[model samples]
Target: MAIAEALLAASPQSACTAMIDFSGRVSKNPKLDIRAPGKLSLSHLLGWQGYRMLALLLSDVLALKMAWQIAAHFNQFYSPLPPELNWGSWLRLPSLFWLFAAATLLFFAYGGLYSSATQWKNYLRAGKLVSMVYLLSLVMGYFYDPKLDPPRSLFFTAWFGSVVLVIGFRLLTTLILRQFEQSQSPIPVFLIAPGDRLATLSHLLEQQLNFKGQSASHYQVVGAALATTAHTPTTVQTILASKAKEVLVENLPDTALASALYWQLRRHGITLRLLPSSVDMLHRRGLPEIFAGLPTLRVEPRFLSSLEYGLKRSIDVFGALVGVILLSPLFVAVAIASRLSSPGPIFFRQERMGLHGKVFHMWKFRTMVTEAEALQAQLEACNEIKGGVMFKIRHDPRITRFGRFLRSTSIDELPQLFNVLLGQMSLVGPRPLPLRDVERFDTWHHIRHQVLPGITGLWQVSGRSDIADFGDAVRLDLYYIDNWSLNLDLDILVETCRIVLFGKGAY
Candidate 1:
């Protein structure tokens, strides 16, 4: 655990240098000063660090072998090309394909698609890079041989399949490696919180870090750190003495003890992590730097780059188009039912906060009566949820007969396909809140607006209307923002289907 923390503390480039330095000393030279800070060159090329280098090499070799095998299979299955065509005429393709594959692999690596830094970042980059490689391969095929060019259909199949296969291969490797590491050298984590808060933090970490609800074999709570100064020093001393790798302080109040304990842990080479707390650590200043070049604190925000944003928008457009086409029958049925059930419009367009806190008219099929808003004030005292956010009663009297059905099945949200097509929402992202909700938000809540709102999101699939507390909702939203990715989005979409079909956690 200490080794992992030390490695994590080092920059990616430094970590690569350290690995190279260690490797060189053991294999080639003995007197190299690999430990000297900032001495190593090739920092940019450090993406080829440690086992990732081996993974890339293996991926290239496998891609080449697969390409050749595919070419052989194609030659066997398809009629022979004109007499002018020969094996030699297409030999350049496999070579060029391998070269492009290697370049794409490196591109993905450099983009942090292969790093532990962020999960969603990795997934997004993988999709875009793989897609780009597919397009490039198609263009390369066109240039290679116009007369004996492979069928466009075959090219598309091979290109998409190859990208999928390559990405799957890498993902499998990563999963296997992670599982092995978890089994062999479980992370040594220490929990520091008031005794009352210990169980909650412990359960959360165990569930997240150690799958299967098993107690984390890698993590151990040395002791609890009180928010009060009277016991803070004693807790810190006890924790340091235990030699725990990482100290996680939970539910710490914004107070002097919190600041003192943080600096104390720093002095002893112990990494401090704060759990989900009401106090805004973002406002704290004067953080003490332990390492020479490292920042004392790190804050990660959730937002994709311009390229990733564009790619995501492209996906949304394509998905929304296909979805609307396929579900046109359902859409028509819902619209007719809604009109028959209620005298209001088929669709509900309400002002919701979107990306960057911009106001947009979010679309949904109306699942309430035309005068639903007018009745909100009268029903305020009957609210079931504790949060300041507005939530309707499970047996709301204002809901039309068809509206109840729509709410239960979540079919009312289907019209958001139009919003997605119009670039107002994504197929999967943080749920867009109303402008009134945004006005009530604190600083941390603002993070949700960093990305475009989604038709279905973490909150919807995780619990939907069942999640009554605003704090839980915010945490889930923050978790999604912190860990967004194409794979995660796909997972949420699948889960959303299950939730909708089963009517789980629906109003």
Candidate 2:
């Protein structure tokens, strides 16, 4: 088949779908699109990868210069320069040294030393490239200028110094960058394999690395699909919905299946990583290594690194503080309305489970009668949620006329910003469930306790009170935990705003 014909034949998608699901809801707006779907460019240097590259580059430059200085110092010790050539001149690099330094950097770049490739992060590569550059410079210098004869002491010392220093500097850079990588988010990955291999692939992808008594996985499986359904639009939608940066596929039934999925993901700027059945293909496409005693291909995702979790907390504090200040007027209005509509305090304080099952008082504008909790036993029969782990009533008798508007608009939750500022809650995360709700939670349901509870979350934006089953809500919470990212938080916040404005799912 012709090349174009082969590519066209492999792609199974009918057309590119412009719409993307933010949180179980479709968003057609391309502007607020919060996905980093495309490959990296100059702009990427502004992020985590860029910081790494810059560190390596600076290290290389320093290594090269230090090598030159060391070479000069050694030559001076053995064969002192004449009175005419001062110590400064003896230490200064000649034009020839500058030429060789330039060539060394060029060779390093050619060998992918400054790129995002993990294999090139080792000192061995840097040493090899430095040796090659020095050797090539020697051979070319001999040919270009036959009379160019430097002292043997200076020549060999510089050559050896260049290789050793470059390697040493790079190793140092790796140690420093490793500290930052430990705190960064795992690369979000989607798995595609036969049903039998799906679990194995997920386990491997989520394998944790131990560093300084702390363990963290480099990859997080956000979604998975059987290879049989890999080419379907539903699978494609699931991958996109998960906001996966890379899709890893293995043991495809046919080459076309892989090709088609690749094309579909490529269109959305998502990367397709392959684990070929044959050794030759694995070597060509990915880094082959022993994973869990099984030979496997390591296809690293090109992810940006930074102190994103710290940044998230910083944003939470700043946003919560600003929110309280700006919304104080609304707070007073709601307080007055609640006071006049019902005989109760303006703020309702309930004990809610927070991070690691710690109990804290979560504040909310009162949206029910003062006797609401006392009356809950009588309304259990009318509970709308199937599991009853959570108590919910679409239209409860306890809601006063003014409280209904507060509940519908989500104005009742504004007081929780205090919890956020107090460090008990976040601006975005799994919502904190009441102590009554926590008492009935299944073992797995408490996994949401691992992170700080939030004012809004995937559960609140996905279906809110519209969801009938608590299990489905817990599943969404799990998904949020697995696929958590700064962008995902922002997307949830945007979706929350839209939902609140329209009052789509709230009681």
Candidate 3:
């Protein structure tokens, strides 16, 4: 992560210095001789990201004032307070408020809230984060002056006002920037990937650009090189003629066209993107995952991913909270129905594997009759979804009529939101499987279990209910884990809603 920061920080001239002897090849590509105005430099790319961060940071500072100004105005309407009751100290940014603002900025920076790299920073997320920072400030201020006894009302007012202002500012800024981007030409990009996958990959990347706002309008892939083969002088010439300043490398072997060739281009101010086969797999980016130097991707896979992943964690916490709260009435109704409809338990707790093979008793609203486990062996002939190794049966007799409704409508999975809260699961990830299914797994299949299991995953969202092979299911799960991102999670969640409302649901 630190190395990645350094690469982004590297000066344009120094970082773009081509140590490798690319001069011979450059001569062959005469277009490379002419440095066009449209051609981007390293500093230009860095400037975009750096300035975006600055804009966000400035917005946060402005929001702090908006919050204080609201609090200050509210104080005017109230009766004159005695010295101790006065909550006006929060408005004094020179002393205690200074510390609060500094701490809040630090928290934002650490959380990647200030990063322009994040395209998913919407109002709800920004508001939630702002509320937390102010709440923390309330706690710290208590310690700062134990005798002052700050009014709880003032803290709450400040917290609420800050959330509204910050989110409003951010939303306005994003809309304006998005419009500016939509009006501009896209950044020229050169793509390199396997021929078989190129068209599909290209389409997905184009879609992802829409998500990237300004960056999306900025990226325009002008040419492509074969991933399976090394780049020759002719291929290099074709790339130069396209006037591309960004290179997207996917499925390209490092030995062939990736390492030296891509690295040289990067040094010459062409940005390098070590893309996954599926562009959606970009969610797998839990770190400062881009590399100005291609070799940096090899290091820091463990810790580098965690902080960015915390962004995903925040989504999980918020989604689970909303899901559980909104569904409480439904939860009760299902509990009553399950009990009256021949269920032994309102909620089912069965041991299942999770991240790194750790076992957790996963929770689900019971959707099968009493001792359904004992009756499974008798229903072998009715198995529907699984080819083998895992068990599933469409319209199984073990499920009561009410339970069947729960399964089909996916109401049964709502209780697992509690599991998501307990940190045993994510809102979207590989599906956790039963012990019997895990016992039958092949070696390569275990990789799916590396991430926290999800309530609905690629399998559920893809509407692959007719899949007879467990291996095929595992493949989807693995794909989700590998490409997992907060945006991807939200996409699956939206699709899960569509699938459930439309009649398809995970077994």
Which of the numbered candidates is closest to the native, going by highest lDDT? Answer: 2
Q: How do all models score by TM-score?
A: 0.50, 0.49, 0.46
In the range 301-388, model 1's lDDT, one tens digit per residue, is: 1111223444666778998999899999999989887777779899888998776556779888888788888888798788877666
Q: Give the Cα-based TM-score of candidate 1 against the true structure.
A: 0.50
Off by over 4 Å in 1: 1-311
Using TM-score as the measure, what is the rank order of every candidate, best first? Answer: 1, 2, 3
Using TM-score as the yardstick, the better of models 1 and 3 is 1
**Positional deviation of 362 in candidate 2, in angstroms?**
0.4
Residue 336, model 1: lDDT of 84
Candidate 3: tens digits of C-alpha lDDT, residues 263-310: 235335444566544233332342334332222121112111234566
lDDT tens string, model 2, 255-363? Answer: 2232224434643546566665622222344665543334556544333222356678889999999999999999998888888888989899999877666778999
lDDT of candidates 1 onward, in order: 0.58, 0.70, 0.61
Q: Among all windows of ten consecutive residues in candidate 2, which has the lowest summed lDDT?
A: 18-27
